[model samples]
Target: MFDLDLWREIFQSINKNKTRAALSGFTVAFAIMLFTILFGIANGLENTFEKFFLTTADNALTIRSGTTSKPYKGLQIGRLITYANKDLDYLKKEFGDKIQYITPKLSRTYQLKYKKRKGEYTITGVSPDHQYLEKAVIIKGRFINERDVKNKDKVIAIGRLVEKDLFVKESALGKYIDLEGVVYKVVGVFSDNGGDEQERTIYTGYTTIQRLYLATDEIGSITIGYNPNMSADQALVLVQEITAKLKSRYDVAPNDQRAVRIGNRILQEKKRLDNMTTGLGILIPIIGFGTLIAGILGISNIMIFIVKERTKEIGIRKALGASPRSIVSIILLESILITAFAGYVGLLIGVGVLEAIGSSIERYWITNPSVKPSIVYTATIVLVIAGAIAGFLPAKKASKIKPIVALRNG
Candidate 1:
């Protein structure tokens, strides 16, 4: 039920003691504001983790060859180690059960020409499975298939940006683009969430690039998608196994870290993300509880002080036939009204701050810092309820005080 008289009295009291009202409101507002900013930053950190590490398939690993740093057998240090087609075949034959999809990549840069429009773009020769390893989404036509690799076809899959740059408003599918001197037909157009640079690359068959450029079986690197079902421990063991075998095959020293490098290591990265996420899970609640506790204490203390100041007023009301329940309701309602309004104001300010600073915080790995309004709304309700409860103690105590005693004290 709406109590117009009671609300009128509350507003009158608040107007009379503007300083007290402002101080109480500031306490609740600051707590909620801090709470909002803390959670928003935590969420932003999570978003950063996802965007940074999820660019490639979680189960993928990349193998790159480098010059040896240690001598083994008769080979001297600084010997350049390289991978060939036979290495891919060797892995398939030896660890076929552990491997899901595997592909070799040969990367180069070439000037692409369509009519008079020309732009330099990265060209990567990859097997069909490279599409999955790179997590490329085919927006049009199809990705490179085994037939293209086997037949060394000159068909290419261009990135979304590449298509936009060379073909303009027209679709690039089925159109022939001249790469330097060799012309290749565009069979597919794809997009990548890895951003513009990734979407600017062009993909073709590994064999085609090998035949035209290197004229050898040499590959730039090998990308493998391990079985997703493999546990982290199993993945680690598989990495060790692959590393040992590859080093042995190349006759590099066992500890020759420079000769063979394994990148991606998503399992390890994921474990770190998991740990950090768990820490955040623990952190958010602590922040909420801390803010709530501070707000409760602040509201409770102010309510006590307000009741002290209003002792003579309360006694006069009681002498004039005011009920004990009315005395408590006035204080409790005042606290709740102030708390609810301040919390909402704090939420809006926090959201505004997040929006204003979102662009500038990318360097800190915080992206899209924000809190759901509903969550803050729910928190505000909780704070109001808590404020009511906190004010109840002092209100109840004042209601029980004898009118003569309160009047004397005031």
Candidate 2:
């Protein structure tokens, strides 16, 4: 259905009214371009907010023991539940493959000293897995390794703030520091951008605490990190399974929910992500279509003007035996071509602007603001439909033109 003569006529008419046609096309193009930039920035802002919520691993969970709140199976309500090294081992043995990182965690307030500098700070103990689980960034040297944990080395990793306070003008790495009466060598200098609290804590090998300062096998907690993409229901299933196993092993009653507490950081993150998704689901259509409607109306109005200008020509064609369908088809095809061309130009410019913005803001706030190809295809399809609808009324006007009246008016 290619018609060279019809297209030639259409292009000739367009060229004749270049200024007016350009104005109409620019109107449509500007509207679509605005919509694309707005949508991309909105998506980028959402992602930036999500990053603030995730200071640690994206799918992290924590287990801590608590006193019993209710009596079950004839047990006393006031008894305190406890987690030990055995619990950490059992969980790792049973669910190791399902987890990305698992670590035993214990923290105690201690007085730190180096020469004349002295301050009270939190000293945490952990295995090598703590590096990823807590988002620990070791700026110099290395974090605790497997050999350090097994050998119970008296090596420690101090936070940047701690280094500033205790070491003063010298590098803290490979230096000696005193905790109470014991001297432990600093193996690494660490920093965390999360907050001030994260930078106030120090880390040492897990076994160091048990072998030197602590006499008991009991641990403060166990933390687990898993894949973030897992559904809440699936994660809950695993959580419940772990809870049941812990309760059973520790002699706690089956129905007592208060014997232990679980903190699901992943679950919290997933809820936020879902909420953001829902917001986007409602936002895109309202704003995008609102802008598109304005452009569509402009295209419709321009097409009507074009039909009015061609009234005498249409009358002559009808007198020469042109069918009504042919006249309508010509008008519709011209409208479609104009609308489609304008929309494509808008899409190209919009995508370029989004990329420039993304590049400028990638490190500080947003990442990959515009997913270009996805929205491009969607907009292309929308432009076609919009063109059809925009042309319909004008095409009808062209079709209804009586040769006698049109000739007289001309």
Which lDDT tens digits does candidate 2 get at residues 1-410? Answer: 88899899889877987886797678768877877876787677667766765568766789998877777677778788888778878988887676778888989889989999999999888989988887889998988888888888998988889998988788998889999998989999888877778888889877788888788777888888765556666677778888888887766877788887788765766766667767876887688877777776776677667777778888898898888888887777777677678877987898899987787886756766774566755765576567676666666777678898888776
Highest-scoring model, TM-score? 1
lDDT of 2: 0.79
Query: Cα miss at 310, model 2 (Å)?
Result: 6.2
Candidate lDDT values, in order: 0.89, 0.79
The ten-residue window of minimal lDDT in model 1 covers 264-273
Backbone clashes counted, model 2 = 0
How does each model score on TM-score? Answer: 0.79, 0.70
Per-residue lDDT, model 1, residue 179, is: 92
